[model samples]
Target: MTGRLYNSEQIRDIEQQAIAEMAQGDFVLMQQAASALLGLLKQRWPCRKRLLVYAGAGNNGGDGYLLAAYAQAEGYQVAVKCIGDHALLPKAAQMAKKATEQAEVPLLALSAAFKADVVVDALFGIGLNRPVSGDYASAIEQINQSSCPVLAVDVPSGLCADTGQVLGSAVKASVTLGFIGHKIGLFTADGPDHCGDLLLEPLSIPQRIFAAQEYSARQVNGAQLLAQLQPRCAHFHKGQAGHVVIVGGDFGMAGAPLLSAEAALRCGAGLVTVLTRKEHVPALIARRPECMVHGVEAQQDLHPFFLKASVIVAGPGLGQQFWGQQLLQQVLMQNKPVLLDADALNLLTQQTTPQLKQLILTPHPGEAARLLQCSSKEVQQNRFKAVQALHQQYQATVLLKGNGSLIAGEKDLQLLNAGNPGMASAGMGDLLSGIIAALWAQGLNAETATALGSWLHATAADHLAARFGQRGLLALDLLTEVRTLLNQPCSG
Candidate 1:
């Protein structure tokens, strides 16, 4: 719940420090890990009598060996498959292997076929820096193909603890038990896909040890936003809430700005305005009459509306044409808080603008790549780095949208722990931009607005997905849920 994420190296350093401080030494730490793994196995699979452990030649394999020994002592049918040369194991692993052998546990070869109620993956841990190959790779594939539930130790084998990129292929764990520190990779990119039901046990490390190391990123959820959300007083009027102007909806694309405007209104923006193509104004009002709709054809048309707005949600459907570019120019010229998405972001890539103090840029991988002049693949490879790069380049709060939405500011990096695949549908980003703009207009700082808005958007999507399933989930379906969640108290 602390939501601090560390890289593999940082975790290793913390572990070493913890081990050095403990009187029982490194083996005791290993024993604690084994005990925690055993406890989880017993709690999760009480009736299952068999446990198969896949161990490699490092400390990870040692944990599997120790777990096998403990399971054997507990009277379960335990089998350990050593994937590589047993002689290559480190001293601690050899000690665990010896303990397992002394307990009369069976050590099987990689080719041995065995069925189990549960499988523990200790093949590779956070220290893994190379691609899984040969017997190790084969074992991971077999584990994935098996029906038995898998509990990955520390980290799922073959997953980069720093970037969450799969090294060759990683084990898909039913529950990954992370120790010492939470790895940033487990919450981002491919990490979420491979690590199911992530649980951290910290191995009883003291808080001071963690305090000694800086976390790679912090996580934000709805619970953390509750204190910042104040209940409205009876005397409060609509005018007290700020007005949000959405500038987009060029020509054929009118739905984008409407979505943004509606979201803003739903999130408690006192008044919402839409400035788009002249022809789209009638439909915009018809769809949502609460929104003050204005039709604009020229730069001068938006000037008056721009002056009245407290915050601007730019570039939902703003095309990269002359009109969209002109609108973006006008929004950028304003000193008010701005949330830029879609074409506004695309237009940003075309021109250089002075770094504004109150700005939030929400860019998906492709859009981020465009802004950074890199490939989407590169952007995703290390999302933490990408978000940081964006912040440094723009000197603005950058929200990188993906599996784990990351917000990078001048001082910190935060990740959103909500959202699902159902949000992949169109108009999601526009809705998100609107929510952020609304919160900013309502008096939240740019950073708080970005974090809370991201959480609200994702949490609403999750709630809707739980009801109707992920497929056929529309962006509009989340508007009501967003209102409901915003009114509720924060659980954290």
Candidate 2:
């Protein structure tokens, strides 16, 4: 979990260097990887009786062949299937095929439809650069149609190891056992969709081997940020924690700002205020009496609140009309620590302002697309590139939310792997914006607040998803868990 993610070419270079430096042959490394795969399979399916291994014509196929041989020796019924032309296999794979034949394991044709307790996909690998078609596509289709569980070798076949884009079609792996360094693709884009359970096996490569290469990106786990949540002092006062002002909730959109304000309060902000449309005030106060809700019809109405606030959460439920624009302009003028999300992002994209520090922009793919003047598809295609572009353009801490939420700043790029599909509902982003603003108000810097807040928000959603299934999980479901996590001592 601590190593860096490398592209296919970089991983190959690392493997070659490891093999040369350790004097371990390619066959030895293949055997070790095959052993690791076998161990995981046995551990997961102790009573599995049959295994179907679909191998292509590369080192990946060689790993499958070795795994098949080992499974046969372990007294399981093993069948090996070759995709494409078997004669085109590499030297290492040819040796593995020979060993499988020597062991008398049946070699099936690519078109053969068979059933087994488990399917091991070795077709293609991380090096796949083109769309899957012809026999290879047929094999993938067959694997997908099968009811048996599939274990992907190295990476899911046809999945881009660098970008997680599917090459036309990709194998849906029940479990993907990665080797060497972690691939950045496995955690973003279509990666989380195809890779059901991802586990990395380092093949015992020396730590120094990784030191020779640079990491593509690092994941942001909550453990690293827990230290920032120092226990409050015994004599702490509510005013000392800092007040947060939430500006958004246009006409008929009071829930957005209300959610943000409540989240700020739950995250331990000293005091929370909501400045929204006049119509939403009574309902907001009725729902959360602790929040100081104010009805603002003009920029002057927000002046006092803006002056008193330590941080601002902007854009939740804020419309694209003139009222939201005026509020945003005034909020920007205050130069307070700001967490921009929802409609505020849309408004920001429409206007250009001076470079602002102490700003955090949380934009889901669509909002991010508007900010970058690109399509959501493009934003999702290479999220790393898109987030970095946002940070560079706006000079603010950026959190791009999706399957694997990415946080980008001037000096760091982080990925959060915590969240579930249940968080797809509305109000989640509002809650996240509030959490970050609260953290910032609580004296954490912009980058620290963003990193810690994103992790906490997603991890809380995950905890809720575990308790109650992923479906029907509301944004408010995360409040209790968020409070619990913030109060807990840092285990790290």
- Taken over the whole model, the C-alpha lDDT of each candidate is 0.89, 0.88
Candidate 2 regions with alpha-carbon error over 4 angstroms: 1-3, 490-492
lDDT of 2 by residue, 371-441 (tens): 89999999987888999998988888999999888888865678888888899998999999899999989
Give the alpha carbon lDDT tens digit for every residue of 283-397 in model 1: 9988899999988887778888878788988898999999999888888888777888999898899888646778889999999999999999999988989999988888889
Number of backbone clashes in candidate 2: 0
Q: Candidate 1: which stretches are off by over 4 Å?
A: 490-492
Worst 10 residues of 1 by lDDT: 221-230
Clashes of each: 0, 0
TM-score (all chains, Cα) for each model:
0.97, 0.96
lDDT of candidate 1 at residue 467, scale 0 to 100: 88
The residue pairs in collision within model 2 are none
Give me the candidate number with maximum lDDT.
1
